[model samples]
Target: MSLEVKNLSLKIGAKKLLSDINFKLETNEVVAILGPNGAGKSTLFKVLSGEHRHYEGRVILEGKDLKSWKASDVAKLLGVLPQSSALAFPFSVSEVINLGRLPHSTGRVLDHQIITEAMSKADVSHLAGALYPSLSGGEKQRVQLARVLTQIWQKSDLGERYLLLDEPTSALDLPHQHQTLSLARDLAKEGAGVLAILHDLNLAAQYADRIILLSEGLCVAQGDVKTVLTPQQIESLYGIKVTVMSHPEHHYPLVIAS
Candidate 1:
């Protein structure tokens, strides 16, 4: 199964945030959305996650329009980690993560087990009892990731599910950045579709199966890493000179500013 966007477009007053955006996210693949600032990446995520629905085209999941799904059904099929989160009550990290399990009716033992596994995968297990609002920015980001991970932890019995992440590594350090993306790769390998908004091209090259590069609210290129992330495309998109070479380790294209 796949999530298909057909000629999708969004506008806010006089500004067009997205224009004729179309792509298919298949199961078990990580698709990274790359672009400079103001490229409409966040707006696209808002459209997909049901926050902004006044778009021009169709977003279909499992052959049905996404807007037609019930709220609980949408929850079952999609997990979203926004760029930032806020907590008002000073909830502990564990409590915040447990909120992801609310849609399911599992027993306490099973819920605890899933929460534990999610925390471990996010590398936030050590912060279990810590109050979420007191944690550092990077720690909070990891905890939020754990929460979303818990939301779509299990595969649906009907069809494939999806995870939408918006700049999930923005506040993370280098090691945690790799760790978070690695967890996303693992989720994709388990038959979940992943769409991540990322600024770091090298990380996208290493982990994403496909790349969608947007500029001025348009998709300029979309394909495998090597095909879409050419030096010419990179330079044109960012208006900067760059050297593109094979990575010394994995042989994927390594983009370095020159």
Candidate 2:
């Protein structure tokens, strides 16, 4: 029901990418990772998704070590959406979304139902018959999101699932940006752990239940939005002077350039 990372560290050749990172992502919460360029946010994600295993600590999922779980089992439990995905072959958006059903044993009727629901959730249903390669960057991103969502679609069967999103809203428009994060929040509300890597501080503050800020491969601060989005901390992290205030609508901490 929780992802526990303890004393995690990673190195590539002679350079250290992450050092002594620690955090727990529990079900029913959205945690956002924030940092400047080269702050090791992506590296941390690689470790969590089991793509980088040469680290120096433990990643426990549902009371079991991540290394102990089989790759197929992990796939059923965690869904990942990378920053960019490419499709060399011409595949319809619906076809691409159907690929997520590969892991499940559902019948054709059930699969279609799940695919339709996922596309609807991602706001990509209109792009169903469109060729994936012909779509815009934002459109493709949404389709990929639908695929990931479909991968973990049978929420009731997959106990304590997790969604790892790497800048999922980077190519999305204003409304879709909010929509994507809102969907992630909804997933968290459904008792799943959601972890996202975000560049926009305001968006992170608005959607994340907690924030973890990194600098030069080390964790500098981690806590609720109010505690982590302080002006002094943000200024120190991103090297920019900024004003922090309560959002006019939601009253969450809002950051603006000074």
Candidate 3:
């Protein structure tokens, strides 16, 4: 499956947040959305996930309009991991992960299988019976990722699963951050389109096949890391002087600053 956004714009009250946004996500591609704080990155994620409806342009999935797809249908096709997900009541990690099966048919066997697979992929299988509220920040993030993985992991139609992650590693430690991104890259390698909104420039450069730089409600740059992470562009977008260097192993652009 693919995602295409054309001339997209959004506003709230009297402020325009995103303007004329245009991008396409191809199958097996990992695209990172990078921007400064309050640059409408979250809003764009909402639009992509179909959580926000009112917009000026189109969000097309596989050539069909996003709005035309039913909520259940969309849930099966795409899984969204937001910056923060909270549960009012204390639910067991297993219970939380099982919630991902809501979009599927009611069957205990299938639910158990999906939850088990998701937990294994997220490396949270040992914490399955623990209370969600009692877990550490990184643990909770991993549990949430398991939930999303369960939601989209259908063996028969696996190629259509699209993972939308917004700052998935914000609350995680260094190890967990790499773990989460590595899982995302693996998913993309398996023919899933993974779109992530990330703040860590180095992580984005290392994992993302392409980067989309948004600044002041516009997509200022979109391409490989070297072309998109230039010193001038970094300074212009975030008011920071960044030095770009090539990674010794991967040869990808690496960002550093004084």
Candidate 4:
């Protein structure tokens, strides 16, 4: 029903990178991880994605230990889009996106259909024939998103799908930034749990169902947008004074820095 991290802590060499962190990402909601630099957001993400697996504590995926799940089986349920992708291959955009279908035995016809749909959803359909390395940063970001989207395009027998997006909108334009998160929201509505690492408080407020704030490898706060984005929390974490106000046309909090 959810991805749960219990008492999660990670240490590299003698220095601790994460400490006793706990959070759950439930189905059908978008969650944003907000924090100052070096707060272990990316480290938490890497742990969840199985990149740094030597940490203490447990990551429970759907009532089972995450480490016990086979890599291929896990791929069917979780799609991860990191802060950046480094691929210098000459493959075309569509080819890069098609690589997402590798984990599935879905037939060629069905895989092509899914790839096309993902490209459309990620707004990279027009770049289907373009060389992957030739695209701009934002364009490459969308293309990488399309690739991950195709990976978990359908909810397998695994029950619920999950998206672990590390700064998904980092390279996007303002409109495309909204567009990207909107697409994540749509996916969540379809029963996927979305967890993204975001730096923009307003963007997280506008789209996330909840926000988890971390500072210095620990969670500072975690709750609904309005409750967690208070002026006090902003100042304490980022060392900046800000006023939190309700958006004039929307229901979420808007943090205005002074």
Candidate 5:
């Protein structure tokens, strides 16, 4: 199963936010979207998550039109963690995570078990009773991740689940940044499709099976790490000199600014 976007474009009264975007996000792989600022990365993510509708082209989810699926059904098979959350409510961490289970009719007992597992995965078990607003930015980010994890926790008969994360590591510390993407990689190994919008090229290189590069509302290139992240391409995209070499301890490319 796959999520495919073809000839996708969007506009806000002809401003042309995105133009002719095409890509396939498939099961059991982690795909990363890398780009400079104002490259329409977030707008493209909004489209995939069903937050934007006035656009051209198609988003096929598991061989069916994404718009055709019921909101609840979509919730069960796709989980989204956006760039930020503005929630000021004093909900406890566990309560916030429990909201992810709202789309299902699963019994309370099973739901509790799922919530616990999600919290554990996110490393927020000790903060279960803490108020969400009382936590630091990174802590809250992890809680939100746990919530989305609860939403798509199981591989239901509905189909393989897909995850969309918009700058999921923005508020995280150094270790947790790697931790978050590592968890994403692990999920792909367990049979889910994962996509992330990232500014850190090295992080994408380390974790993504493939990379999609965007610039000014269009795709610049898409391919495996070494094929797409040449030094020439990086300098052209960001207007800076750089070096691209293989990581000494790993297989993916390593990028250094010059």
Candidate 6:
């Protein structure tokens, strides 16, 4: 699904969280929202996911205004993984993943095949029986990913499937972070629009097809990593001095603090 944010602005009391932001996303594209702490990246994700309202602007999904779509209708087309999502009740991994199917299933033959496929894709099949609360941070993240994956896989053929993730790798170790993001890239390649908010510049450069850099509630730079991730822009956005170099094999931008 193509997502277009037009002149988006958000405010809370005395603070402007997002200002005049605009971007367009194409199907099967992986886009990264990158910024330092307090850069409004998460707020942008919330706005895109319809979790936050009372904002001025239009979120268009496949050329239709997002505000006009029903919540369930939107959920069927887009899946979101926020920074921290906790299940109060102790639902098992399988049960949690099954919740993703709620939008499609009407008590018919539950598609266990799809569920299993999602679990395997997320590397959480072993945790299918474990209580969600009992799992570690990374495990829980994977379970949540599995849930979103199941949602997308079930309804992908209906419309453009979009995966919106906010700091999905924050709680994961290095290896798991790579694993999860690689899986996300694979999904994007299979025709899902993946938008992820990431703090790690290296990961963003490695995985994102395009990078949008936000600073002080505005989009400061955006494009391919080589163009958008220059040392000067990085320093201006984060207020930290850094060097941008070429990766040895892939030749994409690589960052190092000066």
In the order shown, what is each candidate's alpha-carbon RMSD? 0.8, 1.0, 1.5, 0.7, 0.8, 1.4
Candidate lDDT (C-alpha), each: 0.93, 0.93, 0.90, 0.95, 0.94, 0.89
**Local distance difference test, candidate 3:** 0.90
The parts of candidate 5 lying over 4 Å away from their true place are none
lDDT of 5 by residue, 116-200 (tens): 9889889999999999999999999999999999999999788889999999999999998998999999999999999999999
* Candidate 4: Cα lDDT at 206: 96
lDDT of 3 by residue, 1-258 (tens): 578999999998899999999999987889999999988899999999887899999998877889988787888888999988879688999999998889888599978987998899898999988999999988989999999998888733423778999999999999889999999999988878999999999999999999999988899999987789888988998898888999999998889984
Candidate 6: residue 104 Cα off by (Å): 0.5
Reference-based TM-score, model 3: 0.96
Q: After superposition, which runs of candidate 1 have C-alpha atoms over 4 Å from their true positions?
A: none
Model 4 lDDT tens row, 162-236: 999999988999989998999999999999999999999999999999999998899989999988999999999
Top candidate when judged by lDDT against the true structure? 4
Query: Which prediction has more favorable TM-score, 1 or 4?
Result: 4
Candidate 2 ranges with C-alpha deviation above 4 Å:
156-158
Pairing residues by index, what is the TM-score of model 4? 0.99
TM for candidate 1 is 0.98
Better of 1 and 3 by TM-score: 1
Model 5 residue 189 CA deviation in Å: 0.5
After superposition, the stretches of candidate 4 with alpha carbons farther than 4 Å from their true spots are: none
The superposed Cα distance between candidate 3 and the true structure at residue 122, in angstroms, equals 1.1
* Cα lDDT for residue 82, candidate 2: 92
